[model samples]
Target: MTTAAGRTLHAGALLPELIAVRGIAAVAIVCAHALSMATRGHGGVPPSVEYARLIVDFFFIQSGFVLAHVYDRTWREGRFHYLTFLGKRLARLWPLHVVTLLVVAALVLAGRAAGLETENPHTLWSFAVTFLMLHSTWATSDLAWNWPSWSVSAEWCAYLAIPLFFLAADRVRGSAARIAVGLGLFVACAAFSELVLGADIVTLTYDGGAFRIIPSFFAGMLLRRMFDDEPALVAMSPRGYAATVGGVLAACAALIAMNATYDALWPLMVVLTAALASRAAQPKPGLLRGRALAWLGELSYAIYMTHAIVLQVTFTSAKLLGIGHTFPQRAALGFAALIATAVVAQAAYTLVEKPGRSLMARLLSQPRPARAFAAAADRTGAGR
Candidate 1:
């Protein structure tokens, strides 16, 4: 269904362009990590790839936007259970996390046995914290096993705050109020990053990073409100929407190529993501509707979750083979690793991630018989 405001609602209200963007972002992240691995111990990766990490904030923003679109009404109706919501989210995240952690642990052990070096942690404390998804909450100094899972942990933290976040968003009636809240959340986090972490907001990970996602997340939520209510955005033509998306992304590329500061890149990402989302709402979002893009988007989570393991294995193999010492060879290996990560992510999605999510929902989301019985009794009493 398409809203009067031009918002397209698919099953679960999934936004096509956003999903494709996610797929694109996931691949970019994999590419960045692979580049870093290939260049490990020698020097920095390219400046463009160095800033690819900022793409992670888009995930936060998308999460906030999509979740608000999907769940805000149910919440307003007073029937959205926190446990049920959290359980479903955990079901979505936990399975792949478990699989990746195990895979990384094995790789770490085997790499040690083979006298190959890896920077990933292997200590018991790190293991415990990562297993419990507490590593990003400052339970450890660095990420342990499946280091990218730090974002997953941070997402879990955001999930925990959804009830409060949603309530606050709902109470704030005016667009100005919502915008202020959104900007404040981001600015506060950025201020804290500069004061405490001595870095930009996007640079945080595995060091009180659980809170890092708040600003972008709220920005996404507020953007959803604008998408629904703003006249200029609502009346934008599909061609114009596409142009906005292309323009924002092109601007981002140009800036990155020019070695733009993180400060300059951050707001651009927000605009780029918003444009993609708005374009997805169009009835005919050319090219973004391709099956291949949709397939990648469907597998985006798995790709994001599983690629680190592939990178580690590829790096280890390169080390053992005594190759990839030069920049060209490392670039070639990184490209090859991207392809390998895609394959593994496809398998992980088809096998473990999808089924595990369904199984977890079944196990944790079953309705309580006692509550049902009590509800029935109350109805019967009312009739009597």
Candidate 2:
């Protein structure tokens, strides 16, 4: 779908800034994961781990926002190209993914060659699972692949459902009816998750991280629709912003008090964020709309896709230097790893993902020239 003004509303006017915040969420999740590994005992989680888990809810919310942006733009434009849209997504996401998968396989083969670990059925099975991107990050099993990749499974699932959303919204006609259907589909999907997986399975927890994230993803779709609705259902009115701030504090308290037990309140984080985005998406949010955050947002996918590998390489190198696992030691190690991850992710983005995106952009673009990537995104947003 292409926008006539060459400006398709993303995250309903918070496109770049919202994506910038996604960078912060990626950093938070990776650091929290690494720090929790240092802090948790063999059998149980520390209180800090609970804090870490809630942060993932932020990721789910962010995913929903992007998906909605994609779907709405596609439906509104009336000219979404299926092949080009999916192709762009593949170019943007799959290059790193397929490369990392092969890299893991190569590393495993090398580990076996060096006698670090023996090849066995269980080991081979672990490789097979991760090759499919199903290996859980928190599972006790010694496995491979990008350890943070369970979300990719969630991402692809959302991709599959997007066409269905586009059809419902575009074909269903009346605005209220289209919205009702979208919300209905979102709830039905959520109900299916609860019924099939149990209520506790909502926040991408346990095995839910593998598949149960559809609800959160769709909740994002619904919220995105709400953001675009004519009446401005969730725009940042002064009172609405105040309530969102209050709700965030409450969500934090519940997250802490529940000790990572509550996955149900995850949608609230998106609601709160959309309120803030309502403000930022307005005419003047100044530095929030600056170049740095947008650059970070552009690189955010690389940071997410590469950070775990960076953490492993950083840790493996540190281990070679005989670093210990003391609290302060691990904290310093984590800090160093974050810095290293940022540098490597930037390099990877420049060398791999960015160029791949550019090639796809040029090839799949409308034959006529467009002014910028926003116009390009507007052209290909349906497929994106």
The clash count of every prediction, one per candidate, is 0, 1
TM-score for all models, in order of appearance: 0.90, 0.75
Runs in model 2 deviating more than 4 A are 1-14, 40-45, 118-143, 168-195, 202-210, 233-243, 258-260, 360-384
**Residue pair clashes in candidate 1:** none
lDDT tens digits, residues 329-365, model 1?
8888888889998999989998999999999999896
Query: Distance (Å) between predicted and true CA of 184, model 2?
Result: 7.5
In model 1, how many backbone clashes occur?
A: 0
What are the C-alpha RMSDs, in order, of all predicted structures?
A: 3.4, 8.1
Q: What TM-score does model 1 achieve against the real structure?
A: 0.90
- In model 1, where is the ten-residue run with the lowest total lDDT? 3-12
Q: How well does candidate 1 score on lDDT at residue 138?
A: 76
